[model samples]
Structure formats: structure tokens, C-alpha cells
Target: MHSINIHNKSGHDQTFEVHGWANNQNITVKAGQTSKIPAPDGSSGAIIALHEGHEGEQVEITKNGYGGNDFFDVSNIVGAGGNITAMQVGDQSTLKGDPHFMQDMNAAWHKASQDTRNKLKGFVFTNGQGKVTRIGPIKDSPELEKLVRTFANGKAYVGVGAWNGNPGNPDDNAQSSAGHGNKDILITYNDGDASPDLASPKRESRVAAFEVQRVQVAAAPPAPPANGPGIILTNKSKQECTYFFYGNYWNGNGTAGANFDKPMKNVTLAAGAKSHIPLPTTFKGRVQRGTELPATWVEFQISASNDGAAHGDISLEQGCDGAATIASTDGTNRKNGFANDVLKDAPAAACAKKPNGTKAIATTVGNWAAGPNQAAIDYLKKVVGQKKAYIVGGTGTDDVASKNKCLAVDMY
Candidate 1:
């Protein structure tokens, strides 16, 4: 049999005799009181007696009264002494005081885990002074014996140390050096995995949580002030007339407009004709008149005639007589001569040949379909470059017949 004697510093003193073998037995003392238990000499067993419950009893103890603290002192009275394995005083009392054994163990574990996660990798849970706590992987415990064996075979082992008051400071003299001291454990991976070496427990938890986001960059639009020069032509003439306008651009190499052939319709002025002719929106699919063309020197020419026919015998030709000439030089208006001649002879070279592989030949001459002529088709095919052609006509012998005639000769 085993016994324990408890002396209260401020209250009563009592004794208890624990017979036979008892495990996890609880003994309690009242508030501000003390109790004791006696053990048979030469007996061996474990005893746990707090200041709240009796032998073989289990109860939750709470602190009461101000300046009222209880004390418990356990001593083994048996030779080959029965052990006084555990003693819990103020274990979980509500009074403002230091944490209990369990809480200390938990705190140690939390500190260890945080330190390991930040400074080291691959830590596991182990039993601390009272409960499961975080530490280096346990290789010696039965549950981890296999892992330990494996690590040993691989010349790797994880060492453990008793909890120090400061988990981060592994070198603190406050640590229990009797059991396992502060040391690192080398854990070997079963499948060639590497273990991480951690710094001292006193290290800060460096593992941080972060957020990631994606940002998009938008492209800026073109500036409007940088756009190029523009030209607007207004026809203020009476009597239906056909006008042809031409211009030469400074393409960095030299003047390059003699190759373009743009024909305007026979605008019927009807005494006072007024029409605006804007330059082509784009040149060669790139050079926009108002977006790319600079205000550099350029030559312009305009040709006008009262004859309604696009190309035929002209009884009289107005607006443009003599020959094509320059209307403007070096961004300045030049002396106006036979302006129509200047328009006609703006360029001495003939217009570049249409890229179409074939040319139209007048098959017959008579009242024909009133649709686009071969010239229009060739022009459209050369300029617009449509692979197929379609002709629409109104009800009339001359109109319907003109469709086929137009297809034979160059007529719009």
C-alpha cells in the first residue's frame, strides 16, 4: 500500500492511506485547506491528490475567496517508494494566475509548431509533459518505431528536447536538460524525400499567407492632333460636265501620282452645280489623306468639260483647256493658267496599266443594256478587284441591250 501526506500552508493538514494498487485516483482539499495521504512502507503504486477531492474520487476544482490559495505536498512513504506521479493544484482554477501544466504544455506545442513551420519543415506531433505537443517527429515512440528504424538505417534521426519556457529560444538555460535537451533531429524520407533543418525554437514564424492578383494593361488610342492634311473639292459649275482631278504626292522618293486614274461622274450642274469631292479615304489601303498625308508640298490639277460623254467627240471643253499643269507648288497655290489643261497634263506619263490580266474589246455598237460597261467592269475589277461580276438593268430595249454593250466596251 502507498500513502501521501498533505500540509496546507494556510488551512488544515490531513493524511490518507492508499491501499493496494490504484491508478488515476483523485484526492481533493477544501479552499484554503490542505490534506495528506500516507503510504505503506515498501509498497509501490502511483498517487494523485489535489486540494479538492478524496481518494478514489474525481472532481473539478474552482478557486474561492480572495487571497485564498490552496497548497498540496505529496510524499512517498513506501520503501522502494510508491511514486507520487502527478500533483495538480489550481489545475484549472478561475483565479487570475499562471497557466496550468496542461496549458503550459499546449502553449509550448503551439510555439514549437509555429517555429517549425516558419524556420523548418516536416515536424510532427508528440507527447509533451501532459498532452500531445508539436516537436520534431518522434522516432523512438512505438507509434513511430518503424519511421525511426527507417531513419536510423538511412543515418537520419530526429532528436527531441524537453520544453523550455521560451519555445523560440532553444539555448535558454531554463530548458530541462535532464531528459531530451534542445537538439535537431535528422529525419530521413522513405522515398528519397529530404527533411528540412530548422533554426532554434526562438526563431520567428516566417511562413506568411499572401494574396495574388492579376492586372491588365490597356493600349492607348492614337492621338487626334497628329492626324494628316485633308482636301475638300466643291463643284460650283452649271451645265453637266465631267471632271477629273489628279495630284502628285511627295512619297519621300519623288513625285508619285502619275500612276493614279480616278474619274468622277458627269455632274449635272443644272445652272448652279455644287458638289464636294473629298480625297480618297485611304491610299494603297494605308495612306489616309486626313490621317497620314502631311502638309508637305503637293501638286494638284482639275479638269472639267461640258461634254456628258466619259470619252467621246467633244464639241466644246471648258474649265480645262490647253494641257494639264501644276495648280499648287510647295504647299502654295501656283499661277492659274488653263486650269483645265493643268488638270489634264498634271502628269505627262500615261496611267499605270490595270493589274487585270485581260482587257475589254468593243464587240458591237448600238443601243445596249443600261448597266455597267466593260470599262466599269475592268475599272472595278482592277480597282475593287471582285472575282465575279453582276449587272442590273431597268425595263427598256435600249436599257436592257446596253447592259451587254456595256460589258463589251469600257462604259460606266
Candidate 2:
């Protein structure tokens, strides 16, 4: 009568033996159900679930949901169950095993569930001159035949509008060409019928059949680039960026020398530029932008490292505006697919902890991982007017031969 404190998470009506309460022998909590027990004198009790094979799940109950939990609703509670009742299940840990508390994690779940469950089944209809005609099948029906005749070129543009099922579809639009397995409605039209009197009923199947006997074609993977497997990095950023790639191949523990630790690799990228890098499947690295420490970077891996799914994480370890992306095709399938990116559909803080070492990457084949090709000017001004004077290098780029083009990253 006060608030629903005891809940039955079982599959049937569970009678719980009430203890430490007056004039109450048993409390029946329906399967996946909850109930309120009014304690006029303000009493407390424990309810032992009388469920088959589950007699051990005992729950404690109180007038006000105890232990700082608000199974009790104030002004802050929201939807479905709230509209059904006014109670709220704020912190469920207090009433941990209460079936009804936070039963629907999302408040709109109940209404959304009911709507999905009560969806209309498959129905067919014809619309001609602002009128919806036929309700069922089309064969031998004069109404549909007449509807088709009204349209121009004796051709009716069949737009299969509404298709509904329990969860299978309403997810995807009804496709133009039929036979995709979900729900297909193909409209066949003819000026004449297959009556017993006619020598032959003209049932013309639409679209070109075999245009094959004419010349057949089979589906194949996309054509690979003239160069071996590799990734194409495009610089779409307005500002010039210096990009770097360092492999994960570990050496002892040095930075620049032939010892270990120090790693570096980078190329200049003008505002709008593109570069393709041919790498090995054994290549594991980091692709980043900027010249100094703490620049924009993302962990990029687009090739099959596991011989299956290639994964790339948006390592916000260093930050990016989130537009950087690494996309590539499969070596085995030769199909263009799999794009790993930052910011676009990914959240900033979502991808935490990511890599790339310093300029030692040149001597180091791979340290962090890999970026693009564009002549981005170094931040250091080389003109004679400034204080720290240094001679400008003629051009910057190194040729590194790699086997098996395994990755590509796009930094925008």
C-alpha cells in the first residue's frame, strides 16, 4: 500500500513467507513482479522467495526503500513505470534483488516494447488516383489490373512503402530489387489473363533475364591498386601538419642509437594533400600529427593482425579534432573496407590511452605505427631575419621499401 519494496525476479508468481511482520503469513509476488506492503505501524520484514529451485533468494523490505536508495519516487523520477505508477528506482543496489527496481533500464522501454510487440502484420494495397485499393494478393484481381492500366506507359512505379515484422525489419527500408529474404513484394502486370480459353497466358517477368545468354557476369572483389596492398592518407586539415609512423617492433631499451626506446618517423602534409604508404602485415604502429610533444594522434591498424577483424582504437591519449581516419582494403579479399577514425563518430574521452615516439623513428623501422604525404613547412622559421638561424634543407623525404602494403590512414 505504501511502496513496492519486495520483488520477485522469478518466472512465476512467487509466494514469499513474511517474517517480522504482523497479521501477514505469505506475500504473493507474481513472476517478474513486485508489490507494495503498507506498514501502518511502520514495521520491517524479510521475505523468503517460495520459487521452485530458488528458495534461497531472500530480500529485505521497508516502508521507505532503505540504505539511501530511493526505490521511492520524489519529483525527479521519470517515464514508462512512472506513468504506470509514480515510483522511481534511483539506486538499485539498496534493493539489489528487487525485480521491479530499474526493471526497465531505460524508462521508455515499456512503451517502446509494447509498440514493437503490437506492430501491424504484412498487408498489401494499391494506390491509384488518390485511392488505396487492393488489401491482399494481386493475382486475378481486376482492381489491381485496373490500377496498373491507369498509370502512364502501362508501367506502374511500384514503391513498396510499408513492411513490418517483430524486430526483423522496420530496421531497413524495403529494397528496390526483390529476394533479399526479409519482405519482398513484386508486382507483375499483364493486359491479358491466363484464362482456360487463351492458348497461352502472357505472364511477363520484368527485368532483363540472362541479358546473360547475351553475356553473363559474376561479382568479384574490387581491383587493387597498381602498387601492392597499402593505405592512402589524405590531408584534409586546413593547417599544415607533419605526420609520423613508428613500428611496434621492439628493440632493447634505447631512443636514437642502435640500442632501444627512442623512436621517430614523419612527413610533411600541406593543407590539402594525399600520400600512399606500402607497409607489411607484420607492421604495427602509431600515426600522429604535429611537430612537438603532445600533438594530435590516433592508434591506427586497418590490416589483419589477427587473421580476422582488424581493430583500431581512438586513442585520445594525445588529442585530435577527431577527423583523422585510417581506412584500407583487405589483402586476402582485395575489397576496400574497414575505416578507423577519431572524433567523427567517436567520442573524445571514449578512446583513452594510445602511441608514437619522437624523431628516433627514422632509424627505427617501426615504433608507434604510421600518416600521409604533403610538404608541410616546419614550424621553425628559416628566413635570415629571425634570431635562431639555421640553414633550410633542400627537400624532405626518405625512400623506405616495404613488403605487403598493409595499412593506410587519412588525417584531416
Candidate 3:
């Protein structure tokens, strides 16, 4: 049986302890808001004591100050044998007048038994001005013999894979050398020539059962559409359409010439005139319409006027109007020539056009495809009767056509 779960997504109020180095056994998780622990037949490394900010502060891994930010889970221990033995015990008042942790003399404190060497040797803390720190006599120290030559000689560890540092407090745009919020001490075996010396303070070795996982930090993705869904092109055609070129004009001759182009600057609406085109507020697939290629929608070619010299060559079925040029790539070639029963009361999922198999709904303006400008011939001249033209190369015609203004017609 092995279990440990403590999730306090932080809002303050947290205190924990779960030590267990090779069965010394421990469990103390109390801080209202969340905590749990269970380990019956497993444990070799686990020490996560924190008090870094309020709650008796005083624990600084290095650099800044203010302690209490911890995480040590030896992922299930076992490693330390090339020459293991270290002892420094604690409580010269949480030691560290220049000390770094070391304990393990002669196969476990010399087979203990002097009252378990005076109640299992020392280590007591409470500093940051509140006083009270300790570290015992495992070897008449001289400042731990020059900090045991600043340790660097191998096999003597204390667990949590011989833990290391980076315990919070970096501010100013996060920088513990750039590992972010940081906490990752993972090592598995061949622990030779360790370091941080001090004889046997390999993070105070104790391993048997290990697995500690708590990672919460991810939330940012929601901002697009600041202004892009307005389109209304009504022109009820009286005979005039040009203002094309937004994309897809390969008229460079391939696939039998007239590849596509028309509709562009002729200016002659006298019958209904209306324009308000603005469709690319982002997030649809591939935009960049000033085009040299990048385009997922937008293409409106017109013909009924030669003054513009047939713009890009005009041909998507002789420049849209009486409909029939549908080569589609799914966006139903932009709902061909609209006027779907004049939107009889609208609504059919708000009609993005395309489906006139009878719910008589059809709408879509700026995002192109109703073909041949003047907002698709003024929506086929305000529709009063017989209308259904389908252009892109012909197929469904009975005369009168025009439609395109879908994104629910925002035009603003």
C-alpha cells in the first residue's frame, strides 16, 4: 500500500510533513483545505517540510530568504553503496553557523544504544530571530572539519535521490537560471563522487518508497475576434460589378486559360448601390488576403462590363450572376448565387446560405462566393420572384441571383 496526495493549489494556508527514510516512518499533514498520506510497506525517501513564508518562517535554500516551499519525493529509493557513512546530528540550534547536513556513522550511528545515543541524536529548528537551532556531537566539530573539504567524494547520501536546491524566491521575471517555478531532483544510481561535501550529507539519505507528483500551472488561450465579423454588400443589380481582386486570380493561363478574374473598379451602381466589406477578424484557417497565395476564402469576379477590361480575365462562369460555377472546396464554394427564397423569415440555423433544398434560407455577404460584385448584384436586385443561379461554371439557372453575408451579417 502506498499513497500520498496533497493538493493545495495555493491561496495560502499550508503545512506538511511526510518524512520516511528507509522506514523511520512519519506522517503529519494538517493545514485545513487539503492533505493525505498512506504508506504501509514502502518508504526510503520523503521529506517535504516547508515554512518559508508566515508560520514560523526561516528556511532559505540559498540566495534570497523567507523559506517554506518544498517538494522532495525520492521516486522510490535505493542507491548509496560505494562507501556509505556520515554523521553530524543536529540542534546546535538548527546548526548552519556553517553546516550542511551529515549523519550515518558505523552502520547506523554505531549500533545505537546509549539511550539510542541520547534519543536518536539531534536537529531542532526555529530561526529568523525567533531563536532555537541545534546540531550535535557526532564528531567534535571544528566547523565540520573545513566543511568536510567542501564534500566531493562519493557515496554517503541522505535520500530524495540525494536532493539539491532551487527552493523558490527568484522574482523579477523568474530566474533560477531559467527553470521556471522549479523543483526537479531526479537521480537514479551510480552516485559516485557526489559533491556539496560535508562528509555524509547527500541530502540526508533515506529511501524505500517514493512517488510525489503535483504539477498545476496551465491556463491561457482565449483572445481572438477583436473585430472581424461585419459584412453587408447589397447591390440589387441594375448592371454594374467590379472591385474584385482580394485573392485567387491565376489568370496567368494554366488549365485552359481564363483561370479566374473580373470584378474590379468599374463603379456603376445606379440601381441599388451598397458596400461594407470587412471580413477577416482572424481564426478561420489561412488568411492574408493581399494574396500571393495564402487564402482560404474570398474571391468575387464580375463580368457584365468591359470598361474594366475584364479585370483578371473574368470567367468563373462568365463572371457570376445567372449562377453555375461551383468547383467547391467545401465552404460550398461560398454558397453560389443566393436569394434563397428571399430569406422567408430567416432562421434555419441562421442560414449561412448553401441549403436551398427547401428551408428557403440563404445569407452570406462579405466572405465571398455568391459571385460577381455589386454585393452579388444587389442580392439579385432585392428578390421578388424566380431566383436560383449557381455559377462557377454553370449548373442551376433560372435567372436572378446574388447572396453572400453570412457570419450572421455583422457588417460593422
Candidate 4:
């Protein structure tokens, strides 16, 4: 159920062998690489042995902690012991013998079976003065050694979540590893001058030959509205246009001076600029450019298809563009300017200026439209990954929303 993330931050390679109560398998992590080991098959827990250095001769573990306990001891049954100089568990609440972790930790030993009671557990890594504390049982008697040998199973797959490099005795890093249960453990080895507590991110040293960390799993949020495909009506003309936008998804403005019928009323679109108008899911609306026109406006609708794909159609007339509408809060005081064709939803795209569409559709269906900036729209037929398709509307235009270089790019 639990897993360990091994960060091989050392210059040399490292091998993590899964053994003990969980599973048995050897994972070799190349320098600069990160990997994971999981306790397979719904098992409660398992012992992870980290074999580091050329000769692999390190050993330092807390020892047999009881049921559901996070603290434990390590031993070297084989001829392997003491080379790795650093170790950390969780957030280091237990390392440096923090009073908090050290307080109730000794109690977990009492919870173990009687034979395991012979062992004593305490801090395994260096303290503030760089004084490395003693590891293993308090008294190394034959009985305790046999008990440790029984647990070691005649092999040392020793493991610690971190390392401080004992290059002379390369075989020592393999002598000790704390057993892990249901929590994710991260192990990053550091050889350079650094703090013994390797918990914080601010002090991470870049001089590692390699490092490994768990690929964190997080719950995903809802799909963003801007991620949904939509339509963009760009304006390249020199005359500023008053754009009125409304639809079934839009709840009309009821403010004192605001229009009561349409959601977007008396919105201004300057000449030579563009605006981003959002189309909601399962949408059906009529796009009218000017207050009056030579012909009727274009009607379009979109519905959610299987997966994240969508299917939509636009009823194009000869002229939906080239028009600017002028009106008041109510549907009165209507005036019109020269408008252009509106009936074509092809693969054509342009960019005058960039536009960033807010992710509003993720919450509710409402009248959403953005503009007064140079923008463009594209079909986004196939995105290699989640990277948005880059749509350039030529020299005079810009589409910021479609050109997100932060997450890689697919030029169109």
C-alpha cells in the first residue's frame, strides 16, 4: 500500500532491493535518476535495502518498531556495516533526535513481540555538532545479534532515505534501511556540504550526480472552461464597435443602468483589435455583429461529445463580420455601422494581439465574452499533449491565449 521514492543524488549508481514483509526485488537507479518501490499486493509493509557505493558496506537502521508504527531499527547481518553518513525519515521530526519524535518513539518498541524487545532504537544520523550517534541495539550481545541476524536474513540490502557518502567504504551504504508502511518515503543522497536535515527544498544542493524523487500523485481539479474549444470573432477594421453578446447560458444584467436582456451590452471593441467570446457547453446562440445588417446573423451550437472532444456547427450567412452595433441598457436606441460576413467557420486563423480567456466555464454556464485585444481562434484539431495549438494572426494580430509557451508548444 505504501511506496518509497529513491532519489539517487550521488555521483555513483545505487541499488535498492525490496525485501522483508512487503516484497523482494532489486531496483537499480542510475545516477541522476529517481525511482519508486511499492509494497505490492495489498501487503501491510516491507523492508527496503539501499545498496550504495562500490563495496556497499553501510548499516544503520532504527530497529523493530511495532504494529502500524513509523519508527524502526536497522541491522547488518552480513559482513556489511557503517559507511553512509546521513539518513532522514518523513520530515525529520524523528531525526536529529527531535524531542517530539524521540519522545514517544521508544514506546513503539515495547509494542513489538518479546524477542524484538531486546533491541533499542534511537537516532541513526548525525546531530547538530556533526557528531554521528551510535546505531543498532544498545548492547550488542549474541542474543541480540542473532535476533538481528534472523531479521537480516543473512543478507544486507541496507537502506536509508539519504546518504552523506563514505566513498572509501563504498559497500557500507547497503547495510541499513528503515522498514516503511503506508506512507510515501523520499530518499535523496547528498555528498556535498549540506545540512543533516534534508527536509526543506530551499537548501537542496545542485551538485548531485543524480537524484530521485517520487512522482507525486494529486487529485485533479475540474476541466477548465478556457480549455473547451470556442469561437473568436476578430476585428481588423479601424472603427471601434459596440459589441452586444448574449445567449441561453447568459443571465442578463439587472443592474440599474445595465441592460436587462443581454449579458454583454454596450461592450466596446476598438478598431484594429479583437475580443475573446466564450462558448459554453451544449450551447445554442445567434451571433449578430451589428444592430442592423444587410442579412441575418450566424447561428451556432456545440455539444459535448465523448471524451473531452466537442462537436459544434456554425450557420454562416454571407455577412456576419464588418458590423458594429450601438445600443443602450435596454434593447432601445439601436444604431448600426458597416458589418462584415458572419457565415464561415473554417480552419482559418489570425492574430492581432494576445488574449487570455479566464477559466469560467469550469464552474457554471454563463454569458462569458472577452475582448478589446488582438486575438484569434483555431480548431485545435490535434494537440500532441495538453499543449495548446499556437495560432498566429499574422503581423498585426496577437492571440495570447492560444500561444502558451509555458507548457511546451505546437506551432501552427
The TM-score leader among the candidates is 2
State the TM-score for model 1.
0.16
TM-score per prediction, in order, is 0.16, 0.26, 0.16, 0.24
RMSD of each: 43.4, 28.7, 27.3, 24.8
Winner on lDDT (2 vs 3): 2
Ranking by lDDT: 2, 4, 3, 1
Candidate 3 similarity to native, TM-score: 0.16
Clash count per candidate: 40, 25, 61, 59
Write model 1 residue lDDT over 184-258, tens digit each, in one string: 111111111111112123213211221111111112221231112222222222334344433321111111212
lDDT of each: 0.21, 0.30, 0.24, 0.29
- What tens digits encode model 4's per-residue C-alpha lDDT throughout 33-138? 7676653222323233343332222222221211112222232322221222223345442222111121122233334475554333332323466333223432
Q: In model 4, which range of ten residues has the least summed lDDT?
A: 359-368
Candidate closer to the true structure by lDDT (higher is better), 3 or 4: 4
Query: What does the lDDT read for residue 278 in candidate 2?
Result: 60
What's the distance in Å from true for residue 206, model 1?
46
**Residue-level lDDT for 199 in candidate 1:** 16
